[model samples]
Target: MQNMSLRLRGLWADRSGLAAVEFAMIFPIMVAMYFGVVEYSSAISVDRKATQVARTLADLTSQSQTIADADLMSFGQAAKAIMTPYPGQPLVSYVTQVYIDSSTGAARVQWSKELVIDGAGNVTISGTAPHTQGTTVTLPSTLSVAKGTFVVWSEISYKYTPAVGYLVSKTGMTFRDVAYTRPRLVLCVTYPTAGFSNCATPL
Candidate 1:
């Protein structure tokens, strides 16, 4: 028993393999932490880029006084440009002009254009508003338009896929953002060819 005790004491005093053992225990945790940081940072970048995408689309549309099918197509193309370094196909976006009726103080969609991108970032556009056009829909008081006033609302959605996808709870996360602004260049933007009209209709 004394010999066993001496051997244990010698082993306890030996530090030759301490660092290797410590590193063996710590290596996996360090690796996980490193990967976690990289994935989280990448996700944040995509989310913020998504917000900018919505804002840029809205800003571009608001600057235009009129939009046609071709114009809508151009707007969709612009959305892909806004995505920049990010792949655009995973993005879905749309632009709508919300008009407020002076007589009844009701807001409705006047014209809307939506865009879907392909794997190569080319956009396919649909001129229909996702929500009903020329029909009353709820609007935030802040977005409330004055008599005959119009606001352009832009909506965007992005699917973020991580390089190490398993780091997140799901394989990916969906990020969405919406932005609204009054028309910058014209009282009411017109989409005469969008299959819907009556620019000044009140609610």
Candidate 2:
């Protein structure tokens, strides 16, 4: 019985396998934390890219006095290119010209364009504007503009999926951003192809 007790004490004091045992207990948690951080960082990067996409669309459109269908398509392509190093097929972007009423200070859509890239990398520009003409759109309070002026509005959305299902949502997540800018050279950017003679008139 004394020998057995001595062996038991010796085993309790043994430190040779302590590291391995501790490591075995903490390995899974360390791996989980590592994957979680990677997924979180990736999500943040994609979110920033989404914001850049929106800004690019709005900035490019705002700089133009007159925009045609081809110009809008080019802008879409440029916006898609900004997502390089990452799959751009899951991105959706929109460009809209909003006119604020001079008398009532109400904001309404003059013309809108949508760009969509499918999973197969096929690009599509909507034939019909998603936002109806003359429909009211709420602008952010911080985006103050002159009552009679126009603001170029851009929106971007991206669907991001984690490479590993261990940390983030396995199904996926969507990141969206919106940007607004006043027309650079004109009161409003006109969509001539859409049959708008002036910025005040909605097509």
Candidate 3:
């Protein structure tokens, strides 16, 4: 009985594998924390990139007095370039000119362009403006402008997927942002391809 008691005491006092056991218990928690932080940081970065894409599109278009189809295409390409190191396939952007009616204060679409990026990074710009000319568009209340003036509107959307599915969503999350700017050199930006010579031709 004494011998058995001594063996039991020795086993209780032994500390040889304690460190390994503690590590085994804590390693998973540490890894989870690390991945959670990584996923959150990546998502935030992507969201900022999305906002930048929107701002870039609007800023570039507003700086030009007149916009051509080729120019619009170049703007889309610039947006895609801004999203480098991140997948551009899940991005879609639009640039539109909104004109506020002098008499009624209503906002209408002057010219709109749609830019789509495919899964292979192939860019496609609509041959014709997507939104109908003269169609009414709702502007944010904060984006008020003088009557008969014009504002350039840019909208961007991106789907962000985390590197590891364990921490963030496994499928994908969508981030959207919009920016508005007035034309830099002209009262309204015109698109000749859409047939309106100037901003005063009834639309």
TM-score against truth, every candidate:
0.89, 0.93, 0.93
Clashes of each: 0, 0, 0
Expressed as tens digits, the lDDT of each residue in 102-142 for candidate 3 is: 89998888888889888888788866676777899889888
TM-score of 1: 0.89
State each model's C-alpha RMSD to the native. 2.2, 1.6, 1.6
In the range 1-203, model 1's lDDT, one tens digit per residue, is: 99999999999999998999999999999999999998898888888888988998888878888777777668677777766777887888878877777677777777777788878777787545676777776777775467767788889988887777657756689999999888787676777776544455533
Q: What's the lDDT for candidate 2?
A: 0.85
Report the poorest 10 consecutive residues by lDDT, candidate 1. Answer: 194-203
In Å, residue 160's CA in model 3 sits off its true spot by 0.9
User: Residue by residue across 125-182, what tens digits does model 2's lDDT show?
Assistant: 9887867778898888887788888888999989999899687889889999999998
Clashing pairs in 1: none
Q: What's the C-alpha lDDT at position 99 in model 3?
A: 84
Candidate with better lDDT, 1 vs 2? 2
Error of 2 at 112 (Å): 0.5
Q: Stretches of candidate 2 above 4 Å error?
A: 200-203
**What lDDT is reached at residue 166 by model 3?**
77
How well does candidate 1 score on lDDT at residue 101?
72
